[model samples]
Every structure is written in C-alpha cells, then in structure tokens.
Target: MDHKKVMIFLLSSMLFISSSGSITAGESSEKIKAKLENIDYGDITLKDSAKVKPSFNLQEVSSNETKQNFYDERIPKVNLESGAVISQKNKQIEIPFTQPLDSTDEALYSHDLVIKQLGLANTPTLIPVMEYTTRVEGNQIIITFLVDYTDEYSVQVKDPYFIRSNGNLATPSDVYITTKNAPVNVDSPKVSLESGTVIPQINKEIEIPFTQPLDSTNEALYAHDLVIKQLGLTNTPTLIPMMDYTTRVEGNKIIVTFLVNYTDVFSVQVKDPHFIRSNGNLASPSEVYITTSNTPVTIESPKVSLESGTRITQSNKEIEIPFKQPLDSTDEALYAHDLVIKQLGLINTPTLIPMVEYTTRVEGNKIIVTFLVDYTDEYAVQVRDALFIRSNGIPAIQSEFYTTTKNDQLIVD
Candidate 1:
C-alpha cells in the first residue's frame, strides 16, 4: 500500500477526503469510513481555508450495493407463450412476449435463438438460421424464418440479455412448439426395379427399395391393389391369375419370392395406388420389368475316347480304358461279357482274343485291363454300355473294339 498525507479541513470532514477515483474488486466506499476514525483532530495540522483555495472538484458518488439492488428490480423478467402452433403457409413463426421489446433489430438478435426440427422417431436436427429476422410490435416478437422442413419444432433462447423499451434488460426464455406440416414434402416416396434383374435360382429373393415408409403392410398391398406379372415359359410369360408369390415388408423395402424357373420374368406396377406414403401421398408409379436367366442346358454322358496328352500304347501290359466317369464297380465279373479284346484278323477284320490271361479292374474313371502280352502285339479293348455303368447309373456310350481299340486315330482333343 502506498502511504500519503491527506489534508482535511476537519477530522469529521470525510466527505472532502481525496480518493484515487476508483475502487478495487468487491470494494465499497463505506468500508473506508473507519480508517480515519482513530485519528484525533488535535494532532492534525489545520490549513487556512482563505489562503489555500481548493483547485480541484469531486464528482458525486453512491454506494455500489444500493445501486445493484435498484438495478436488479428494474430488469424485466420475460415470459414467452407456450404451445403456439405455427401459422401461415409462409415459413415464419410469431413469438408472443410479456413486455414490449426494444425497437432496434439488434435487440431482437440479443437473445440468441435456435430452432430445431423434430420427427417421430428421429433425433433433433438443428436448423441453421443465418438469414433469420425479427420484428417487434406491442409486446409480441414476430420471428421470420426460412426453415420449412420437419413435422414438429423446438424453439430455444439462450442467455442473450435483451433490452426493453424502458432501458431495462429482459431475462432470457425457452419455448417448445409444434408447427404445421411443410407446404410440400420433398421426401416423397419413390421406387424402382433394378435394371437387368434376374432370379438366378429357386427360393431366391429380389429386393425393391422405397424412399419412404409404406402406408400398409405387404399382405394388405398385395391383396388390395397390386399387379405382378409372374414368370412364364420362355417367350411366353403368363401372368398368374392368383397371387401365388410371397411378399413381406422390411423397413423401407419389399422382399418378393416365388417358385423360380429359369425363364421367369417379372413386370410389376401399381395401378389403383395401394402403395402410399404416410402423408397420404401416392407413391410415384414406376414400370418395373425383370427378366430371368436363360435355362441351363442338360449335359450328356462323357465319351470314352482318347483325350489330349493321352494315347493308347500297345507296349504297356496294362491297357487303361477310360470311361470319362467314375465306374460303379471294379469286379472283373461285372465287365466279363461287356469287355471284348480284339486283334486284326486275317482279312483285316476284328477278331476277338482269348480272355484267359486278361484281368480287369476299376481305377477312378479308367478300366485297367492287365494282360501277359508283348508290347509289339496290337491288342484292342472295348467297353460296352451294358455293364460299364457310371456311378450315377448312367450307362457309358457304346465303344467298339476295332483294331486294338475302336479306331487307331481316335483322339478326343
């Protein structure tokens, strides 16, 4: 603390005491009245008032506590009307206040207002109002805005102290409201079929997506007014008389299923309009055409002919006759009559060789015939369709034993 000499005309003349023209935080002038109380008038030197005329003046002052109490009473407490439904097709809402507000546009903005859009089961979404405006009249505040989407709304006011017409501050407020539906719903339902859509197999599903919730369930839509062109034969699609296909509703989509055929194609549309939105709006009509995949071809039995990288060599003692499929049995008795070993006869005709030393066994798809013959001997082997049956019971195509085989130049490749 800096100590200095204070010249007072009298000991009781505290009103004339010199101040530094300021007070510290949380300080009051009344607290300093006792600082001069202990001093006696006899010890202080008196100055001649006539000779020392004061060259300065003091400003009027009052206690801070008294001023604070008076100011608090003048601050107007504000109240806003609740449950006010928004009016007018135009995008604007009127807020009714309890007292008249300041005429300036800045006073309206002093209360930081926030608008939020509410939905049935969705979280609150903020509506940014950078271009919003407000006009005050009488005791009501008309808040004009461009926010136009949302089934309901939540209006909020922050601690932005607004000033009243009498220079008193208006307290902050909060409000909740439900507004009329938007003039036009941009989220109108839309639906379409996937292009080039086809059911690849039976018991498969084709999902059709919708932009918004459907008005009714799948059963109601199908039974009331729904046109579905069921798949028919190739180039002869027949729209079934009855609704044999199954359908279910999942979220914002419809799942459809049927006894799928390879030639099934679908043409679905809504004519009487049963697929409607929640807001009573008709779902936009879309021509959906779906085609099925081509019918798969049936395969015949594999030929028992020479394949690439494989050829009949007369030198090996065991002649491997492949059936191009797994053989059902490996017992030599099963193929005894069906197998015929032949060689070139005298007139170049096929002559059957004796089967005394020949042994036959099944190895995978090939029939291994073991014999005690020289490599130079041209032996022919035949697998008939009679006993040489496939594992699936399909008989092998008939194979002729001409030379040592059907033909010397037989190559499946």
Candidate 2:
C-alpha cells in the first residue's frame, strides 16, 4: 500500500509542474505574436491564425526580428564659447574672440564656417578656411582666417568646430558676426606694358604703364626693382655694362632704360613690393615679354659726303654728315671714336687726322658734325664706318670709305 501511495504522489507533482510550464509558455507565445502583428515584415503579409505555428518556439521569433533605427543618447555635444565676432579690412575679415580656442582646434581648415551678405537675398557662401595659421602664446591660441569677398558679410559657425579630447564634437558659439562695410577706392596697383614695343639689343628702354600715377619720391627706388631676363636661354644672360640708367616718372608711367649687351628674346619682371603709387597702394609684380633680335631696327647707315670744290675750305674745321635716322642726343660723349676722321692721298703712309674735339647734334635726318681740328693738313679727308647716332641711342650703319684719292689734293688755308 505504501509503495502505491508514493507512486501516486510523484505522479501528481509531475502533472502540476508540466501544467505550470505550459501556461507560462502560452503566455510568452501570446505576447510575442501580439508584438509581431504590429511589425510590418517588409513585403510579407500574414493573418492572426498564421501568427505562429503551435510547435514553434517563442525564442526563435523574438531573436529574428530586426530593429531599424536605435538611438543611444550617450554622444557628447558641441561647446561654443560666448563673445565671438568678426572684424573687417577691405575684402578680408578677421574672427575675434575673447576666450582662446583649444590648442588642437580644427579652425584652420574647418569647412563648417559660412559667410553671407546679410541684407541681400544671395545664398550663403560656404567658405572653407583655405588659408589660416595658429600659434600658441602662453595659455592662448591665436588664429587668423584669410577670407576674401566684394561686399559686406555676416559670419556663421556650425556645430562641431573641433573634436574634444573625450571624442565629443565641440562647436563654436552660435553667433552672427557682422563685418564693417568694405572700402570702395582701396584697390591694388596695376601695371602693364605698352604693345608693339620693339626692344633693341644694344640700348633698351621702355615706359611701363600704370593705372595710377606713382609717387614721385618713390619712383627713384624702382631703378633696380625691375629685373631683366632672357626667355629661351639656359644660362643667365650677360647684361650690358651698367651705366647710369635713368628711371623717372612722367604722368602715370615709369620710364626705364638700360644697356643690353647681347640680343635675344627677353622678359621684364617687377621684383618686389617696393613699387608704390600715389594713393598708398603697392604695385603688384608682373611680367611682360619683349621680343629682341640682333638686327638694328631704327638705324640707317649714315651718309658721308664732302663739300665740292677744287680747293677744300681749310678755314671750315667742321664736317657735316646727314643720316636717314635721327641721332641719339642723350649721349654725353659724341666724339672721335664715333666719327673717325682720316686724311687720304699720302705717298708713304695715310695720315690719320687727329680729332681734338667734336660736337654732334641731330636735326631730323641731318647730323651736323662740328669738328674743331687742332693740326692743319692739306690731304683729302673722309669719314669712317657707321656712326652711333643719338636720337634714341641707336647706332647708324655705314659703309667704310676714305673720300680722298691719291690724286685728290686740298689746300689747308
């Protein structure tokens, strides 16, 4: 009887545990099915009876459902200090702040900055900080942002201006920085070379054109500020002997003249910011091409002739020669080396006339050569090869010839 009772009690305990498990599982399954009904499983459609199979495990259905967007509220936020504004000068604006930025701030090249014309309907210009630099002085960080524009501006800085040490995006204080109005007349000086200028190989001079007249006192500083270079040459060109080159200002132009030793294609460039205009604007350096050839352009061979008479006038010590081009008048020393005077018709040896002093002046195509002869000779005189004419410092070409022959005679009286 005791064995029978023990078996019946064990059977009763097992029946109660099985029923409790079934009730809990049924409740869990009902909850899971209710949650799945609200979820749109993409393209698949199902009804209440098809909610779940009777033998399906509730854990499998709960594990397979996907969560599309889950937000975690633990991300760090941006921090923008107060009192940040902008200052203006011409087209450039400066962002000023009372509190120094972090040493590792990305403000230099940050793309989150926006500048806009406040009054206009124009779209805000997204100006990435293209040019900027940062320096640390004591506990402060100094940064300069270089921005250019044509009108007034209002600056805007978005969130996450910099990344914090804790991996949080820190933004500058949200503020509208209104810049002052830009100046209208303050423009950079402009320079250009006149076209159709024929550069000579020997004596080269050009008048540089300017948008504004240069300061007279500062014009003298540009005597050496202009640099001359040969274009196609591999090596530096040998500049002609450095004479007293004249640099002067006439109206809105600067005239520069220098001696060139060799002839080839050349270029002229302004050296630095030393060139200044009357309006206090510095001249922007520029380069211009100058084509050069070895052939002389403005010079024609000088024509040498003698006054006709059986007896040459001895009293007239001057010999006059006419040229097809005007002579260079600025040449201070126009003497015997330029005009070689040699007497002809010598039996033993030709007697070259010693030129003591000479004067040359160009009147249109005529060059009056006034020769003050020291010694008197009765031989026929003639001029030598081409003379360097001085209207614009161009050398005149000439065919060499001694005017007087062996039979030719002259009375030096």
**For this target, which candidate reaches the highest lDDT against the unseen true structure?**
1
Positional deviation of residue 241's Cα in model 2 after best superposition, in angstroms: 14
Global CA lDDT computed for model 2: 0.45
Compose the digit string of candidate 1's lDDT tens values, residues 251-359. 6665666544433335555445433443334456666444333333113444576643354654356667776667656333345456667655345645444356566
Q: What's every prediction's RMSD, in angstroms?
A: 22.2, 21.4
Clashes of each: 2, 8
Score each candidate by Cα lDDT. 0.50, 0.45
Q: On residues 1-413, what C-alpha lDDT tens digit does candidate 2 reach at each position?
A: 34333333433332222222231233343454443344343432333324422232344234432221111122322222342334454544444333334445544424545555432234356445554344433223333446544334445545644523233333454654433442223455667554434454435565677777765655665665567655433353634223434467887777766554433445556656444443444467765435344445543333443333433333355544555455544432343345555553356544443334555565566555555654344444434442333334333444343342222355533
lDDT of 1 at 142: 66
Which pairs of residues clash in candidate 2, taking residues 3 or more apart in a chain or in different chains? 80-173, 301-397, 327-390, 327-391, 328-389, 328-390, 328-391, 329-390
